[model samples]
Target: MTEQEYFTVHHQLTINAEPLPEGSSLPSYPIFESEIPAPFIVASEFSHLDMLNDSARKELNNSDFKHVINLLDTQNSKLNLLLTFLLSQQDDPTYRTITSAFGASQCTFLSPTSLNDGQYVRIKLFLEHPAAAIYCYASVVECQAQEQGFDITVKYQLLRDADQDLLIKAALNQQQKLLRQRSLDRENNQ
Candidate 1:
């Protein structure tokens, strides 16, 4: 998709953005299943429901199965809460940063320090509403200075298809909520 077509939303999500160790290189292509990192394996397991929900949507679009989809989504949120509890022990506070905007392809966050262009970083993102976690690698695409801090945008690299799908779903869901809120506000003002 063109960059403009790639949907992004202004949402605050906690992310751990740690620069990869010196000399580290990120793969240009998706990581092989066998070579996937342990953290990402756990993340993929938690994100399994996103795939199930997507499949149900495709199969039952506008059908009575909307209830089924809603039920599945509710279950997914509960599972994510459990996942959050399980992973909380492993979470490191030092690397945490809040994303200013994010989508399937890229994430932008404010950082006290600027990252070099083309730098590689390992990211662990936490979705608050859905309570899901994502682990991936990213390449620094841009770092622009803001009044308070630098705004760093990182392009996702070597992301598993499932994780990317989850991100896309999250972005669309957030957009829907924003639109609904705006509509409600307009109605109330009239």
Candidate 2:
């Protein structure tokens, strides 16, 4: 299949490889999706978000209401952490940020560790904005050694429909955030 079949975006990933045969053909395994939602928002956090929104709405009659709402929105925005992540080094110890390219069908990224082509591995992804985490198994399609590390391409296997949807949604959200950043940067530069 063509690479363009699904949209791609740059992101950071936490990866773990399951051992396989010394040398093998394309490996296959089931994907393990994280039960936790992204942006680390849990059921308990909904009240916090709702409270912020409620506070902002109650002040609609104030003279500076618009600006006040904007301020609250900035702090409570779902994408706030993601924007910060996109601009700075994230503190998560699980996975390091690499120049990652991901789509619905496959993902390619760079890493310090070398994984053989056809090797199966567990991948953990923290997607931007609503910051959902997805865990899945993939087979290495290609692994080229670079001066710095390994540039690896992988095709996903045994992913559930929901997990596939999550990947696609994350890619779309990330692309939107990247575009937003680019536009804002352009505006400031102008």
Highest lDDT among the candidates is held by which one? Answer: 1
Backbone clashes counted, model 2: 3
TM-score per candidate: 0.76, 0.56
lDDT of 2 by residue, 155-184 (tens): 876455555666776677778888999999
RMSD of each: 4.2, 7.3
Q: Model 2 lDDT vs. the true structure?
A: 0.59
The residue ranges of model 2 lying beyond 4 angstroms of the native Cα positions read 1-4, 17-19, 23-99
Stretches of model 1 off by over 4 angstroms after superposition: 1-5, 21-23, 27-43, 50-78
In candidate 1, the residue pairs with backbone N, CA or C atoms under 3 Å apart (3 or more residues apart, or in different chains) clash, namely none
TM-score leader: 1
- CA lDDT, candidate 1, residue 85: 76
Tens digit per residue, CA lDDT, model 1, 130-165: 546677788899999999889999998766677777
Error of 1 at 117 (Å): 0.8
lDDT of each: 0.76, 0.59
